[model samples]
Target: MSTIAPARVVLEAAGIRKQFPGVVALDDVSLRLRSGEIQALVGENGAGKSTLIKILTGVYQPDAGSVTIDGAPVRFGSARDALKAGISVVHQEHNLIPQFTVAENILLERIPTRLPQLVDYAAIYREARPWMKTVGLDMPATRSVSALSAAQMQLVEIAKALSLQARILLLDEPTAAITPHETGYLFRVLRELRAQGVAVVFVSHKLEEVFELADRVTVLRDGRNTALDHEIKGLTQDQMVTYMIGRSDVLAQLPARPARGEPVLEVRDLATEAGARGITFSLHRGEILGLYGLVGAGRTELAKAIIGELKVTGGDVLVRGRSARIRDLRDALARHRIGYVSENRKEEGLILLHSVLTNMSITIWRRLRLFGQWIRRSSETAAVMPLVKQLDVRAHSLAQQVGTLSGGNQQKVSLGKWLAADVEILIIDEPTIGIDIKTKNALHELIWNLAANGKAIMVISSDMPEIVRLADRILIMRNHRLVGDISNSHDYEEVSAAIMSRLS
Candidate 1:
């Protein structure tokens, strides 16, 4: 009898150790990738998943350990070196130049040249076409990337990485912004690449995706490897969560609570310039209202309209039964005590270049002024410290740059600023996007506590289980219109069915 031979190892990192000022980012971590296999690198936030990816892609150097390609030891001095060594990565954040055309960005690393060092525009578009089609991006290659939505931008990033045609591809939360249909297409493409003997490293917070796509799994926790290169077959999601978080009960469902008392926010026949039309809803004090929709369903735009970021073309907004003339975000926060936690947290929620303290205290800087004059740094620190502890944010100190923290910690700071301002009505968009299961549970519990404390919360999420778990009522939107408002029964099947029915 003849048997098929095993695939060869494409890349391996063994005994990796990395450290920062006050944190050991990675310690004795190891990862192995085989050709013709999709390997999942998973862990909770701060578990060294991002740190490992950076080290593998040459964004950071490891203090210890070695990397090997095809049984040959190699060292990558920079990202370019890694790419030259047949490695490419699509990070969690968008790396495309917004003003550039899609074709230009996709072929950025290897723009074709003509005679006399001249740029070749025709060659750029022609070379980018196949990659765009491979990722199922239907837009024209000449379109400006800035005009694309977040989901479309994510697709462009994937296309750009695929254009490299690297032997090893690393993807970090690649499906975080795209719709289910787009995710299905990407999965098909990844499978094709695996069949072509390309090694893939997929990093995501979604467990189902991992099980569906990966051939092997590597689990990390506290910068250490808990499981390395375990076959995906016969592995359960519960086991995976335990490996990541050291506990399987982190996703316990929140208790259902019905809304009561007077409406805190009332939107009547609201129409916005962003395409939301005739939307009407009432949010009561201590109520958790969910906004559910697919990508480009106008969920985020509706939240922006409520907070005055988008122009209201028609209808009225009432707070506490009184007409609210919210002119802008400042008016929404200061005059009306309405706050929004944007879905695009990296760009819209927190200032990455600023310190954690600065980002967390920005919302209340005006309120913290002494005698309506200058604000004291000591006072700012005092105000944000409690929230840092409350949110269990993992950072060296308040002075650390917000950009340096993990995705989950950044999200905490994003929501922490609004909590510091003590906003009565809060709009949180995609609260758990790209975050780990443990941090997600913590945030969900925090949201529940906030609502219990008489704060009305509007949660916009594509996560069906999250919506079913937290929201007292759900408003379904499709094609920029609200189609259904159903009381959440906290049953996943029932809630998901109701939501899909409305979406259809």
Candidate 2:
């Protein structure tokens, strides 16, 4: 009576519904992924993208839904269950053990056993090299994953999925941490996987990549599909952004530059042992200085040197027209009233298991105490509530664990963590690395506001558009050296060429 589809149906979900205390994350969402199609899942922050993916991957069981793989209905109670059903998820953050070899990480649970039930290390090395080569990753199976960079680790995660016989692969923000060359490599792998009849659900906020790689793009807003089957062809980036946010007015709310005042920070011949050399810069009150470069271009190194995280080999730092000795981070904080928002949010910034209030209050603990021995919860709450409200941190309450928040919210916590400490000179590194478009604009507004209040801001980012939009003056760092400065020009090509010249 009915003809079945010839293509393999890798996964299907029906009426998925997920709820939290105050957030209905997913509401009756339905999706079907075919064997070889690259389906893109896109939305603004807190738009149920992560929740739906978690449901599919069995990280969280849907309160009301049914998942079917190869036409067989299944209830996946745990991640192990989902993996056993031929599904694998590679998170934005790598989940591999750093100390383990690539071969061990690839064959994490199902390592081939010898007759004595011991791990066959030699066999593992022999088996893993070809798989790594298949993905165009050139690394020995015996090498530790810790020694690899961020992009290399991502390749390892994909390789691990390939080892698991992943019929359906979930890539959550795969290109966020990679370089342009590595991004191309990843795109090639995605194409190869699609050709081999492996379904992929790619989640990312970078619309360019989404349209470039996906066949069909699904847009979700407030747990409902705006456009589930929108073809990528003939789709404008602005139109896609509008569909995700449900409004055309977001672009009009950009900040207007008023003025930039006198110099608040000055550095001369600043050099760090870790490749930062002969750097000289100045930041004025009510000014936002942008440092743009590739991943290892000494942008962050210069920030650390200025903030006293890295020792200055031979240089002088002046704050508000006075010679300052920033021997250590705390000393710099105490003497110069400086604050730094680290690039690595999870590892360097926030305590995941701690509540938002606790993370915000960690810096101002003594300020809220009556006798420096007892904490005043009310005072701490009062002090943190305004910042929480101002930053638009979404949660049931400030008591919610920050780890449970989205990437954008986590970044807000990182920024708020420093703002709560009352730092005048703020150094923000990669403020919107993995954030969505909506969140990125919100953060840009916040940074503009901070600069408008006469708080000197130093922004270091790899995103060229962000740097061009925010920087009053742009400094190009290459090979740990400040090559050129763009003070009066906002020309993208000129600035980009200046930074890229050093790589050549």
Candidate 3:
């Protein structure tokens, strides 16, 4: 029975190498995927995880090494070629078309073709249902992709992979926005897939989930394979951290700061257009306030209302002891000096097609002119370049489109844009969502420094540990209303209880 349970190698990469203009993106990185096994890939920001995944999925061709599937060498020239070779990647970003129905998005290209090669719409919907069920998704197949939440869209991504009959799945940060319930469902599906002899490579920053789901763990650092193992049962989280960072001393130690000063923001009975109930909160100078809740709990809605992006049906907002009625984002920014980092950075924050310098300087363009009549490109680069450097935004050049950078680098640009704007009150929604650990630590440090400088910060996160680390006070919202507050304690169980109770 033990011998039968052992799996054989389904896919193997031998000495994979890739390079960018100024960087050795991947250097002799080797990975093994066994049939019916889930392999966890753990790494920091520049650890070559993305590079390797791209090579495997044929997004970027490798300079050296070869990929073998079931003991046969294969060269994949494109993502479609990789898919044809039984490799499917569910990226952190959902690639589904928002205007299309779930059924249409699922069977996007492979819709049953008639003899004349016309699309069979009814056949497409029929084929999508069982795939959705394979992942515990039950939304109407006819529903538009635009109507689904982040978690639901994630399920659709998995279903898309399944529709292609993927034997080797590469899931990159699939659970970042997923709730625990949804995560449980996804894990169950992966286990079933493993039982069916499908190999899976799971990439995530969540150490706890890695321990729970991975059959083996591989750590990458500085574009090299640092550690590989078939078992992580004996390794502590601290050990994993050390392997990923290449140093035991890189763990973050929160600075001990004095209590906050005067209140900078006050909300009384604020309600959003999304029907969040009367919500009240206060943010003090040099303080970090965290808002936590289950999916659909209205924490994001509250953030939207506070930022004045959504209409407030009731209540009032006060900025530094003065009654302020924020009817629009312009009013909010001009009067309150508020900065909002949205959860979906691609959609709500950065203009992906624009240059990094342009994205970073757009908010401060009015202040960068010589006589308020002419634009200064040199001055703009001088002001934005340092910020890009400080934030460690990786790109070939400042002229590169923001969309060309990796997910983590794009997020840094988003944050840099807000920092350049010099916002007084910062509302960060899921600040580290989909980012690797190294980048996460950098962002956490940046937020702490911002708070220390007397900027009021409201951190909205689904990650319980993140809220526990940085927030001076934690506010739990459930069903569009404030549930409870926890302070001066780092008990995740307490926060979990509050979140569960409010959600229930």
lDDT of 3: 0.85
Q: Tens digit of lDDT per residue, candidate 3, span 231-281?
A: 666777888888898666453557777779999999998877898877888
Model 3 clash pairs?
A: none
Provide the clashing-pair count of each candidate structure: 0, 0, 0
| Candidates sorted by TM-score, best first | 2, 1, 3
lDDT of each: 0.89, 0.84, 0.85
Residue range with the least summed lDDT across 10 consecutive positions in model 1: 1-10
Candidate with the larger lDDT of 1 and 3: 1
Residues 411-497 of candidate 2: C-alpha lDDT, one tens digit per residue: 888888778888889999999988888889899999989998888999999887788778888888777988777762556677666
TM-score per candidate = 0.90, 0.90, 0.90
Model 1 collision count: 0
Query: On a 0 to 100 scale, what is the lDDT of residue 365 in model 2?
Result: 80
Worst 10 residues of 2 by lDDT: 1-10
Clashing pairs in 2: none
Best by lDDT: 1
